[model samples]
Target: QRATNVGYTALRASMSAAEWLTSEKSVEITVATTTLDGEGQGADCALKIHRLKQPAKAQRASLTGYQPYPVRRGRRVADEAPKPDPANPNSWELGEVVAQDGFNTDAAGKATRTYQLPPGPYRALLTTQDRFGKEVTALLPLTVLDPKGKTLPLKVPNLVAAPKWSLEPGEDFVALWGTGYDEGRAFIEIEHRGKLVQAFWTEPGATQQTVRQTVTEAMRGGFTVRTTMVRENRAYLTARQVGVPWSNKQLSVAWEHFVSKLEPGQKETWTAVVTGPDAKKAVTEMVAALYDKSLDAYLPHYWTGGFGVFRYDSSSLTSQFENVVKQLRHLHGNWFTDYRDAHMVYRSFPEEIMANLWGYQYFGGYPDGKAHGLLPGMAGPPGKDGAAGPRGDKGEVHDMEARVGGERSSMRAMEAPAATAATVAPVTPAQTPDLSQVSARKNLNETAFFFPHLVSDAEGKVKLEFTMPEALTQWKFLGFAHDRDLRAGLLTGDVVTAKDLMVQPNPPRFLREGDVLEFTVKVTNQSATAQKGTVRLT
Candidate 1:
């Protein structure tokens, strides 16, 4: 690039050195003039040109991905990954400072040079040339919140917490929490100045419970002391757990019949019935789940039998599995996809015929056929010497007389049933009318204070002055089913898909990016009556 005009006389030009100066490159954004239609109404349009900087648009990918690539930056185009700029931090972003055709008059009285400002809040004096000719200084704030919303106070302990402690924003001084306060739940109201703000001590959707209240939005930046004294009449401890008994029944009947007609043939057909008054409801729930906003995306990659992630062996075996194989045969041109987790239920079950009537292992003679799991008749917890139980009276010689056949089998002596019968064990028969009740109870381990997300300190002590009507069984979960949020497909990561079946019109999408992340909390009940008749559907 050459300068067009140098303001020097022709006589002095010969005296001037070959190069008087090397012009420093400085970016400037000047508004352009555009005539409005035929009206000759001119409007201002600006072009910003500067040394090409890093990419302005940033994006993130989830853990589950078809192909994973980090985001960066570039001069000509946006790179995959762009780190937060400590110097010109995205602490705040006010959109891109776009560049286009632009012009400006230079120092020697001649128009030259393009213009661009590193994407901006349009704050003045960002780009500056140092002696080294490099980007010298950039001061910018991070753009944390995207889209329009009130600035929510920073949550307690942060959003990535095990037990997310958050505050709800509302008018007035109310500062409300979305976590537990007491066992059942409790809330406190503080009179801030002359305004009423609630200090609630409860978690919403906690065990399917929602307690809403108004609270103080701001605090005095100091700790407020609180004290409460209470007395109660009781002995041991009483923690009430209300569990509804609901049956989920999936019934299938399949039979093979040989025809006596001219052509001797075999025929097999199956009828599956999901029964009970709640069957359709359950079907609706599952069908809804297939396409449910939280889960629809990941149904295809689901692993059956309660496992995480997709194993290559499963992908291989799924093709030959009875369900996939039979579906291919039965449906002919159309085939069922093995991705649905329920295919584990719909597929051909383990057949006892695989074992002969004598119950012999069928694959013992087959090469490369490894028998899986435990044998049908294996007993006593895999490997233990102990038998079922002991015999009360066994070969005893009492008073020096060995009486043969002295004992007779009683009616309760019959063989135990091969199948298990469900039994209900009550913690307490009933709360006693008469029990020692006292005030200022010093008790630890309150059920109301339990939080799965929060662990109580082993050294901490809590006081409760209450008596129990009966012995209470302490509970700490082990091998328990995962909460429904994960199992029901609310966690629709990269591999989730809606192809299995859909609960139409319900689409679950995870925020690929943004603020104010939210998820649904589904509270299922056996029937409307199960939850005080507040439940609209079973």
Candidate 2:
């Protein structure tokens, strides 16, 4: 049984080998046989054989993968990748393939695909291959948009003439004026360098706009004016550089009632007011130049200096040398007096003379025999000394002298009298009220109010009544309203709550023993008539 099993295994092995060989296009086999005689010597025979060649198997090619390039509407998209051609492996022709709904390939074995679709979400079914030549299908998401659809036209506000070149720190105001669309909102922003320093907004339906801002330290070096017009969720921006002025006293010109529109050849007179001390000075100078004959206010003239002599002339050298020597001599003389006082007046007033003049006296100075004696008539006879007056009484010392580590003595000579029973009164203790029963007043100093959503009635009016906080201050209120028709309105005002007399106190939050605190109070008088009052703090 084991021998039979071995024979079956060997047969299976031979069959497998034959099957493998037949699978190829061609196969070959060899056979050998030998016959032996009694003498142990025989002839050997060998046969060589060959199988007929089978037809070659057909090869099929498939797409590997593709790369996508950036796509835009109305623009050609060129995407290329390794080609998927088995038959034409050596082909180098590059081509672009357009698919109705599928991918394409080029002649150079590189896949080039182009997509032209409208604005929508789409999935592209791409056929590709893995490293093992296995086909792989990819699902790619695509979004397209129309290049011209839903395009909004930009409308910018036309700004007025530039503001003043320079402004005083706190006294000058920058006025910005412009014309804008009747609809939407307009914002004016002042920027120093590239940073926004201040901004102002204008309400809708205002065709003409004006805003004024005070010049501040942030606007010192220079600033730019940026205007933005917002409508339908879109903003259009425009900017202009108003150069920084080098002078603080620059003149300002303001035009009134300037005509914005006129027909061809039409004339409209506009009045411009020029202000500042510089403007007045300029006017004065102009008047003086026109009317004053002695004034040398003439236009400048240009002149060129030259030495007219031939370059090779011998005399030219001599003249040039002479000129150089003269210039050097003049320079040497100027150097001595450039920053030095060389005038005769300065020499005449020497240090000794100046000192003597500073201490000079017109009346009697020295004795008659001295080197510089007094003037003969200016001297007068010395009067005899007056008799001594009587002496005054000395002041008595009130403060006592301090002594270290000694018993202090009372300064008073007499002791205070003891209080009698009839003059003494019983002391009463302070009574504190129960905090639970005594309700505390609620603090009503509200600083802000927010009413985000307010609805109007049928009459297109909303009335709201709220108690004002107990804050004696000026309150600024800003509000806006919009209807379903897209119309809007804005409101701004200030309300002041005051009394004839007001008092504010500032006290220390906490105190420690031996600490001296300085308390202060403020008093205000807001009445029409003069008020006299006293402020006392305990």
Candidate 3:
């Protein structure tokens, strides 16, 4: 059977999620003030706020079998993806705070209201606010204690803030993290030697936010950082202190011996120019890396003529690079080598070799945008006679040597050997290693293509600005368009329309004898042209 042709067109736009009112049934919030478990003086105040989880409705696509033609429309696949909303049709967000005052807490985690009034019937309002300016309000009865017997306790807001190092390898920046309830915005203050050096405000909407700063040796002894969350009239505060050390101190302890063994010429080639006696030792080892024929290593060192640039703690960055090497060894069935030997692992271009074999020239482009194909005559490990030997299971030679332009021919020659007429046992699926996880963790391999826009300005000064894609969308032009026209879209802006299809069985999991079970298929089209296709099951 053939599929039918159905074409459609639609425009797509992304808008922020709508906010829900707090008093709706879809939103549940409980605010209570309590005292510490003590008979008299030890009694403390605390506030507990609880929110109940609400179920959401999922939009599923209808599945149809043996369609006649393909459907075409103009939209991205992501736009076609189903966006299920909450089961409650009117529900959205419930974090808008109306009014809040007089919140106090003691060391024992007890909470109380700020105002002091006579012990009698009274009403108190508790409010919760979210980053989207959505708020919910609850009214409860409050009783004031008699002044003659005991004084009423005060209320205190609970805010949390801390400091941590960034994840990027060899980075000298530290990020300050903060979170709190009803925090609309946050202000951060940094101090060194009791002098204010930095102050800034964090973005709203997120309960958590981080601000980063470069730390230097001058602020080594004591660098203090603090964040204050401001929600309406209430202010909550938290602070932390850290010590800064020279960035070069992060180099691995094994670097000195590693560089000393290299030939003087090799040392000069891989070495990064470094100052300070303590740092010189670390630079030698840090600068050791595979030479990229291209000048863009993603770091300053590409221009400085060394292995790598930028100061970093060895464990933070080197550990990740080492993990990649280990993964390569496992993939190639060369796991017998000692992990302790750095040269034995890093010097071997396993990633490049794999790319060459797969004909993936653009994959994992080096910083210099040059593809350093497989090394000449380098195949597997050394055999007894010093010739290349097989490294993979079932006598498979993992290495395939190729020159710059003869990748495909070289691969064929390596795979088809004349020496062995006997067939080797096939490797079963169970014997194969999963490279998915290895590929995911190897971000270093994608450094070049990931930051394609790293360019120098008119002043000849390089600018390392990383522009992350804000939204993932696809676009198509109906008429002819040149490169300049596409670039012009950056200013004039262009709209996108796309669609995709998904199929699922009703009652997703289990099926019962009497229960109705149905198959559903959803087709999303995002093209200007009509299409004809087939959809068949089994």
Candidate maximizing lDDT: 2
Tens-digit lDDT track of model 3 for 10-42: 111111111211111222222332222221121
Q: Per model, how many backbone clashes are there?
A: 49, 3, 48
**Better by TM-score, candidate 3 or 2:** 2
Full ranking by lDDT: 2, 3, 1
Best by TM-score: 2
lDDT per residue as tens, model 1, 418-484:
3322122222335322222422223322221211231112221111121221112221111111222
TM-score of each: 0.14, 0.19, 0.18
Give the Å shift of residue 327 in candidate 1. Answer: 45
lDDT of 2 by residue, 1-538 (tens): 3222222111110000111111112222211111111111111211111111211221222223233346544676546444333223122222222223332222222232333433322333344332344443433322222222221111123333333545645645544443323344567777665556678776555544555556664455455666775443333456655543333333333333333322222233422233333443111000000011112236432221111221210111111111111222343433334567766643467764454344433221335311132223222222234322122123111112343212223222234343221111233334322334533234345343445565544433343333444455554544444433223334443445555666666766655554444555666666788754333332
Question: lDDT of each prediction vs. the true structure?
Answer: 0.24, 0.35, 0.33
Q: What's the CA RMSD for each of the models?
A: 37.5, 50.8, 31.8
